[model samples]
Target: MSMTPPPGWYRDPSYPLVERWWDGTAWTDHRRQPGSVPVPLAPPEPAGHGPDRARAVALVAAGAVLVTSIVTGVFVLGRNDDGGGAAAVRTTPPATPSAPSGAAAPTGSSTAAPHSGAASVVVDELNGITLSLPKGWVAPSDVAEDDLVMTTPGTYDCPGDPGLCRHGTVASRTVTANAERSPKALAEQDIDDAANTAYDRDVLGGRPYRGITSHRLLKAGSVAVAGRAGYLVRWRVRTGAGPGGYVESLAFASSVGSESPVIVRLAFDAGAEGPPLTDMDRITEGIRPTGDTDTGGGVGSSIGPSR
Candidate 1:
């Protein structure tokens, strides 16, 4: 006695701001803003069996509520599709189950499948750069307020307290507030802020990792990133609560010809539960300019470990 919703637009299960096509039997790829015209479904076959059509429509409608609830809850953790300019360092926990606030949602699906091989590039059009997303890492789910943030699969309870935490995160964006043009100087200057943002406290005033107590420089020197000259500073920091982690600040010139300095911050918790530390070097070496493939100066050199 159940009825299926006919072929029409329904509220998108993944994002609440828009609607997606729900075909006579299942969901379709078509999506549009709330009030925009819906994409027309394909023409029906010539006078198909009346019972078959009716059955299909019934199935679609019958499962509509269940599918919507499941999909919405699964992808509700950390979804932010806002396209904004550079801002101060802000580390917030994974968004709550409620729909995240932002401008227009992204046009494509919100699934955060892991990338590999040639398709592993994570393009950050906002910063005009791209980085190779490692095998276990997925695209940004708005874990932090950076232009782009690629993180490991899921989150866990922070050892410091009861909040959720991601063991690994790599964030990138252009440096608009600072006037420094030297990559080395910028990298050194930003390391402290990076450590604090990642470990000290979140925007909600929660001390997830408690706070950074001390840090030791692990690496500092010139290098190349995104086809531009850059410098990186890595530190092994100790936190007041949980096992501390590694933080790296890399500064380079933008490949978009604006010469604006770009910064990439990396944070990885130390322990077996966290991602492999080697991922740091791999990610740094995989950065490339988004569009132009001129290979400005090859991969160039890398920063060596220091005391």
Candidate 2:
């Protein structure tokens, strides 16, 4: 019996409702073709690779839509005829030869150049002190600051108020002898001075040296920076000011090439009775140096002033 199919884009009833009798083949009209050759009736495309090929082609089209949307500063969404879901639109890329993997390299790309090597500094954190030095050798600290001779020997920075500053300890006036001193030393000196001058606290470690003084605080480990080695130190203390005024100190040491050693010291004081030790440990534990290569650079020695 002769029957009328649905009006628009319907497949013949004899076919699987997939082959279009209008063009007489599988659907290929992404756009209306005015007078092209009518597609001939053919067997349905094989199921497996056909779907995969269709997916790949859809991805390419999506990429093209995306580029166009980006250039126009607008978003464009699309969907397949199957009603799966909306998809990201993309702009078409310039045609290029496909590689064996069926993917094309980006056009107008330059060859990747090799990186140049710079003089490397390695940090080895030993015990509680950190040292920035060459690989496989102990770095030395001299008793002189860079060209600024210490008028008073062995004193670091002057002590500042703990309430006003992070490092609660005071430092004596001392010369930073070697330009190669790790960041740790300078921070220790600063902390010492802050504790001493501000709160009348004594320094457990002397300037550029360690002392066996009473410390509610401590330091240890190695923290590296930018392929250069340095160390980390953690310390804790209590103050007589606010209710349970406790202070925690942690320092990151990194040797800046030819520049003064960069010491990042962090301190937190909640009260005179908080868990300064716990806080100190937590902060110091999070210090990790980035951009370090495996030339064996790191904190190699204990965290403390070398005897």
Candidate 3:
């Protein structure tokens, strides 16, 4: 006997947007309350004769009223099949439960799930080149064997002749020392004296390699590496193709944690035309001491001898 609105009726549009009432087959005065039961319309009188006809009419009217109420509620709930109703529903998705106060939202489905865009830093034990790589990046065995490392969108290729390596190429080399040598002396030898060196040249996959023209020093800094004091020097150099291509070279040296007295790293990049200082900072930041090191390494090593 509850009275609900007809198929389409609105009592208030700005606030609660309440619905009007329906009485059997027509509108009625049975008003609805905020939390009270709805009142149905007055019933029809009994007809003459058997009274069966009146009962049937009344039943039909009641059925119509119930059906109209259901349809009206569904339409009001924004579940109508009309295009506008669908659009409204889409714009207003189901409300999401709020998280408890001061609790961080859950991360990446589960703790086991790897975070998107997460990069793991891997340091090469031999050359000490640290690579920041995504989970999917494949580390080639050959480069690992050669003590060379690179990130995705990059690959390391060791040449029988490293001097002829191509553009965008990065290369490194090892050198021997007479005695325990500090990183500063080795860096100076590589940059100023050009001794015990490795060079990178420009080469495209299917194109001939180009030659370098001039080499100029840009910036120099000192950092610790692998439990020993180290020095880092960067340089800007010209290429063989006239005034276009350039090269960046970073050389680092440090004692190899009680293994070797000193370990030297000479990294070069071909086809880099920017100021030498830019790549210098990048390569310097990549150098990290594996163990505790002296703050300043007691000044740079003298250039007297390799030892």
Using all chains and alpha carbons, the TM-scores for the candidates as numbered come to: 0.62, 0.27, 0.37
Tell me, by TM-score, which candidate is best: 1
Let me know the TM-score candidate 3 reaches against the reference structure.
0.37
- Stretches of model 3 off by over 4 angstroms after superposition: 1-119, 127-145, 151-174, 177-180, 192-209, 242-279, 289-307
Name the runs in model 1 displaced over 4 angstroms: 1-118, 142-144, 293-301
For residues 113-231, what per-residue lDDT tens digits would candidate 2 score against the true structure?
Answer: 11122112222221112222111111111211111100111111212221011212111111224343545564554454333322343221112111113345555445543344545
Name model 2 segments beyond 4 Å from true. 1-188, 196-217, 220-228, 243-259, 270-282, 285-307
Model 3 per-residue lDDT tens digits across residues 172-286: 3344433425556555655532211223221111111233345665555565443345565555555333232223223345334334333323333443321232432343444
User: Per TM-score, what order, best first?
Assistant: 1, 3, 2
Candidate 3, residue 270: lDDT: 42
Which scores better on TM-score, 1 or 3? 1
Report the lDDT tens digits of candidate 1 across residue range 1-307. Answer: 3344466666555443335555555544343333433322222222245565544421123323321111111011112223212642323233312232222323334322233422465676656676776667765542323344567654444656434566778877667666789999988988877787678765445576777889998988888787678888999989888788898888888767586887888988887866788888888888877666565432635565575
Kindly give the stretch of ten consecutive residues in candidate 2 with the minimal lDDT sum. Answer: 68-77
lDDT of candidate 1 at residue 213, scale 0 to 100: 89
lDDT of all predictions: 0.60, 0.26, 0.30
Global local distance difference test of model 2: 0.26
Clashing pairs in 1: 4-61, 5-61
What is every candidate's alpha-carbon RMSD to the true fold? 11.3, 26.7, 29.0
Which ranking of candidates, highest lDDT first? Answer: 1, 3, 2
